[model samples]
Target: MAESSSTVGKRKCSQDRQVDEKPVPKKGRSLCSTGYGIAFTMHMCNFIVTAQCTVINITMVAMVNSTDHRFQFNDSTEGLSGDSSGGLNNARDTLPAGVPVYNWSPQIQGIIFSSLSYGFIPMLFLSGYLAGRVGTKRVVGVSLFATSLFTIFTPLVTELGLVFFIATRIAQSIVQGSVLGGQHALWEKWGPPHERSRLCSISLSGTILGTFAIILLDGMICQTLEWPFAFYILGGIGCVYCPLWFVLIYDDPISHPWISITEREYIISSLADQIHVSPCKQPLPIKAMLRSLPLWSVCVCGFTHQWLSITQIIYTPTYINSVFNINMRDNGFLSALPFLVAGVTGILGGQLADFLLTKNFRLVTVRKAATFLGNFPSSVLLVVLPYITPSYVTTMTFLILSCGLSSLCQSGIYINVLDIAPRHSSFLMGATRGFAFTAAILAPTVCGFLLNQDPELGWRNVFLLLFAINLSGLITYLIFGEAVIQDWAKERKLTRL
Candidate 1:
């Protein structure tokens, strides 16, 4: 009887142990089996914010080309018989019906376009700091909402006079500037190591899509409805997107209520090698980051990149209209084509970059290759643009290729911050973007002065400036940029217990 009882107890103990040791498969279902929810929402957020950044491109073009404004000729010119002047005179005579131009001069227009950067530059650090402390979801959500509200009020602000209008735009710039840095912070928690490049690329591609959409729609809206409707429509879309962003996004997978156990586990495991710190409790390694040479290289490249990009965005329509004598409707379509090409190539470039990285190519080599391919070809094409005769189709083709090829940089310097310092990427991004906006402040003003001097000669000078700046960025980045994280970042000393 005693032996029988002992045997039964031992058997039960063995069964219990088996039950305890058995693995329980994660029961929670991912929002998407492949984790597309976070990716999709990030992409959407980028699209909305970038649209705000670029809507002015099309709106400004429409306003400048409107029929309500009077066209002035250079009083000092010897003859109005030059082919360029004659072409412009004929184009002005054929202005489309219902186009209403604001009588703002080129300089005023440049100020209006560049005003956003004034507000944009100062807020970069603040936004990143806030995102690090409070969490990106709240910071980004509020920023977008405020930006949209201001955008909706743009027409009223414009009616309030030039001073008030510029003030309002500056306010808008300050608000929207937060989005970029905030998103970078969020990616630290959200982007997986292997998929980081693709994710960042997809999100950034929103800028291209936004630019394309605004250009395609702005012209038609200005012609069919009124210029103010362009503001209303874009602002309304942003407003609608805000609620969705708040509902769908969480700062980290661990905190996301709706995330699956499986996906959460996957994210945590993938990011295990990266140092994680609660931003609220820890200080950023400001001294170390500032001392890092690679970071400064990124900033320098960003400065040059922004100078070229802002010039292209703000002036492309003007260039097309002034040089080729195209109408606003045609300008809209042609301007959008380059961004369309860019949008597609940006995705492809990102995918290819990730694939190469996975193949064990040297990180520095890949980055330089991508940057060279994107910047050098685009610069060559831009230099050729001034030499090309004024065939609308040919000019459009060159512009499209130049812009499209530039998308390859998306795979290079654009996401390099995330590579070198995943934990501090948001702050680094802010630093880099601050430099970019500073360049933005200068580029348009310079272009304005140049274009105002002589449209033909000034444009040639502008293209030449672009070529020089683009090449400089490529050279600097190749010489100084690094993909590996610095030892200071790896120390993880900034985190508090």
Candidate 2:
């Protein structure tokens, strides 16, 4: 993962020269009708935050008991007033205590639902292309408004069969992807170049923070009211956000009257030399993009790291309850620690990566260091976990630290997208996420299938599987995971054969 001297020289000149350049005023770019674009971006950011929260809250509750498999919305009804006559009551009967929640049916359903989040990537990949043909502001505003509507209706689909549940989740997923993809494209139009990472981190961090809010609030609601109420409350909150987006978001800094002149110049000058591609009117070379080794490496890296993460986030409560005999409510509180830690670590990790770059460290060196710090140790810990015989609190402390370290991979994977394919960052992100999410769909089912094979031994096997995949990723990083482009893309152009 070392950067070549030539790459370093090129980057130094490009970055340093840009750092010292005079600002370019964006006087001609209209600022008359951009309030909605600015407001929409912020609004979309907030919606993602809420969705992430809802995901974690519902997942934790769903897997807690085997026989009385209550969905969150269902649980809320029972908690709020003991009126569980609908699908909630029916699903509850199916999930009585002592029944293992890791059955085939729920496993399949979990895969489909979780895939919604990952599916957002493809939606985003196309959005840039779509926005270019249409208008950027129009695409974002309409999509955000539609997405919020779906988020609002998610809880209302309180049916017993799997169709309603999966359909609602799929609908939510499509909308979520639209908002994120649209927002990213829109932000690229407006965000300052040097500050892109920091700004992107801020927007992404909202997701993590929103998740933290959901976990704590949902936990309280689950304890005091019910799980369905958690969704109801989230849906209600989401409704309020849609209007705000319509009121505030803008497509580019220059377009927004509210943005200061200094801010607009700084933004335009930052990316003056770089291509500001409008959406593709021509079809994207998705196939060509997939064939590139550098891009595929990004996909494998994300797949490995995300698999480990999604598994932990979705199943940690199950692990705590089964392995240490902790109660559901206590597990919810303790389980939230890792996500919060990850949120903090995500910010720290991004800052740390930036610091390394500022010190003139090789891009490969910085990214590889972060990748190793995140994945390698977590792999080792998964192996060692089986043998730990500590108290419940001590054991979960290990779990918390294990997940926190994984945030390094999250930061590394994201930054690496920009480093390797700056021109196609959005497309690459989409392609990588599409491939990696197959793992997301698989993690739960694999865990379930394995556990079902031998309840006593399957859990241990799951850890081993996680360890193996993570190690495979570590080796990939060691061998082929460079952050600097190293003329890989250039070679593709020259050797077009």
Candidate 3:
């Protein structure tokens, strides 16, 4: 059943009436409202938790050095051993056998680097459900605490053995996964329709920022103090911040004791049709979703976007190494540049999107526009990248441009779940995000295969293939992606999929 214009009009009118009934505060006061505060805290939570995902990768060198023998990464890195400043020796003095160097093969190191991915996926779907059933506050709150605790103890665990270290990383990732999708559920109650895009983008931008921070800083952190200090400093920040999250954030606006009446009324009125004040659980509408072309459009967008994103994130260093002949240290800074730009653009895109809405743009129009703006140009650039060889300035420019623009998708399909089904937004976010992350595994394998086929043409093939995949999503979403709540997604009966 399509939502008729009459129904749409009613929603608009309802929103208007509510605004009339309880006016939002002045612009200055609204900026400081509790909803924004919650979004900020969520951003901070994402910053630290997502950083934990990459801590192992960043500190691998220092960790290897923390073992019994001297760490000689290569003949070229020999200068690193005896530097007067914080080098291997400095770290060694600080952390005496803190991380035992088992005969961990390169394969084991690869697994440890990827162990967080293993744990992150499993908890995505479950966290979405538990956040709604038990409580978002409890789920997110405990997750931070656990993540911080694990991060803080990682050095101790590594001292025990490699197996223990890997296990702790995985366990830490398990809890860290919850905060990813769990936070979306809160938007149903806390975010007004016009405000949702910016709020969600603001919170999610933390992922990009956190990643950049870790990549940029943790290398120095490991070089100066030791690998353990990276985890310690980051984890300590999380530990201190978790209690504040509990104090400041609430599952819903109404439940927040400190919220001004004006803000609470504004949120409740804006979300009246979507929020389920009384909690209930029933079977998910799987059958309904099977018929949802719009849902599939979103899933495709999520997958294709994530596929390309994961590819760039993992292989950018390799690309720079081979194509630009940049040194390893320079590669780290250059590789992180895209995410930093993306984070900045995501926030700016968020504001621009909301501005469009305020100017009376249709929600679908804005979403589709954002999706197109985010994907089409980037895909074109990506497909053409292989043709432009050995131009460091040009290649780096386009690579950064391509990935930076992709962040606009955060305002598109990223928050579309809330638009379509606020009650099930968290679950949908998890399910779709989980579907997207499948690309994380597939991207590496596919890139490896393509590269193995022909060293030169292989890169071209990878680009063309990714472009084609991304194009399919762009086409699908433009045609079929929607922001309307499905009938099955609304208050439901006791029906199984």
Candidate 4:
């Protein structure tokens, strides 16, 4: 009556098949999964792009402050005269005593400072669209490479003519503008819902770090070698980074060859609720997006942040030199100090925001709290800074506190795009950044006009203007911003006949 061995084996195999056919429960998977490759790639991309964009500003300061007649190119000596020593002495005597020998006037200098934003504004939306259509990997990689090529040629272009120099700068800005949009598009596929704030903060903090590193190193390079080396060194770094970026990064977890199956599944499953349809199939809801009040509030907040930050970036060195009586080398390091603090605070603020969300705090509350802490205190400090006397230590302390506090917004308004429209986050970010760059374009001109009126009083007015702008943005966002996903974000269901 005992069953044959072959029959027993067959029966066991059938039972195993039945068990395999049953669906695994989704609840067993973890809610959040952080992928190391995506995070590291994003951080590196942001760091390099930002360094390329800001290095020119530092180089300009060094050029204007240089005592070398060759940098100014004011000498009329023809191709190494027979008496080289006499020619050198002649060039020195031509320079006016107690006056800087730069060829550029203040008006021309202002134009140069604002030119980058001109190209940056128009390319924002296009970058997002291209990223969605093609892939972020190609878009960002090509853009970074093009920007680097232009940066490497900056010194040569400057010698050509003012118009050519401005044109070159504008081209670089256009390419660099794509980086943010491409990053946001990449995040749509890679960033887990719960980990968005932390990832975004870590990546965006690269801007601060880039600024700090460029400013800190530019001074030494200018002093040790020459002003043009600043451009050569930074541009060379960007060129080197491009190859690594293409080799290591992919658009999404599903496509990444090296990612583990466990991590891939976790990312795909977590994103399912947010991205219902393939991004390519989902038509961008331009009408609904334009009408959204929350999106507009985000744009306003971005505008304020960019205006304040850009003004500081362009003018802070001059402000320090004028008020503290420091040389260009010293000014570079001192100016870099505030951004160093901002970069560190940005990471900490992001972690805190993610932690609060994990505790079940409402998204709106967490965002608003971070923004308030970031902008309000910084605004108050800036208002007080102008009133303080010309003590280098005291002024620097206030500047550091102001910039450092403002960094909390990296976790606040900056991360709100992902919450509001996870699928369309790249386009939303592009729109907001475009508006912000508009502010960057105007900030230098406005500061110049104010400074021309009176140095001390005009500078005070600039700080007051920033305070008002920051406070207004804070109030507007607090009233209108919402962190919840809008109904328009959902794909429409079709009824088949």
Q: Highest TM-score: which candidate?
A: 1
By TM-score, highest first, what's the ranking? 1, 4, 3, 2
Give the TM-score of each candidate: 0.86, 0.76, 0.81, 0.85
Error of 3 at 186 (Å): 0.8
lDDT (Cα, tens digit) per residue for candidate 2, span 1-497: 78676565444334212221334232322234232235335534644544543454344444333412322211132331212343333333322333223332435545554645655656656665555445456665666556556655554553444567566666666666665555555544554433444445545555555655565555556555555555666665666665666556655676676876765765666655443433322335556665666666667877888778767766766565455433345556776777688777866776676555555666677678878888878767766776777466667677878877887764566556655645445455555655665675678778767765565566678889998998887777667776644333222211112
**Model 1, runs deviating above 4 Å:** 1-35, 65-100, 277-282, 492-497
Estimate the overall C-alpha local distance difference test score of candidate 4.
0.73
Which runs of model 2 end up more than 4 angstroms from their true locations?
1-124, 128-148, 190-194, 276-288, 485-497
Which stretches in model 4 have alpha-carbon errors above 4 Å?
A: 1-34, 65-101, 277-280
Query: Which is the winner by TM-score between candidate 1 and candidate 2?
Result: 1
- The alpha-carbon root-mean-square deviation between model 1 and the true structure, to one decimal in Å, is 9.1
How many clashes in each structure? 0, 24, 0, 0
State the lDDT at 220 in candidate 3: 62
Q: Candidate 1, residues 1-497: lDDT per residue as tens digits? A: 24565455433322101111223223322336434576667777777777777877777755553321222222333222322234443443344455455667777777788898887887886787678668888988999899989988998888778899899989988988888766777777777656666777777888877788788777777666777888898889889999988898888888889877878887765665554543223357888888988888888877777777777777777777666555557778888888889888887888787677666666677777887888888778877877877777788888899889888887888778877877677777776777767877888888877777775477778889988987887788889899877665653322223
Write the residue-wise lDDT of candidate 4 on 150-240 in tens digits. 8889888887888998999888889988877666787787776667777778888888888888877776666666777778887898899
Which candidate number would show the highest lDDT if scored against the true structure?
A: 4
TM-score of 1: 0.86
Q: Clashes in model 1: which pairs? A: none
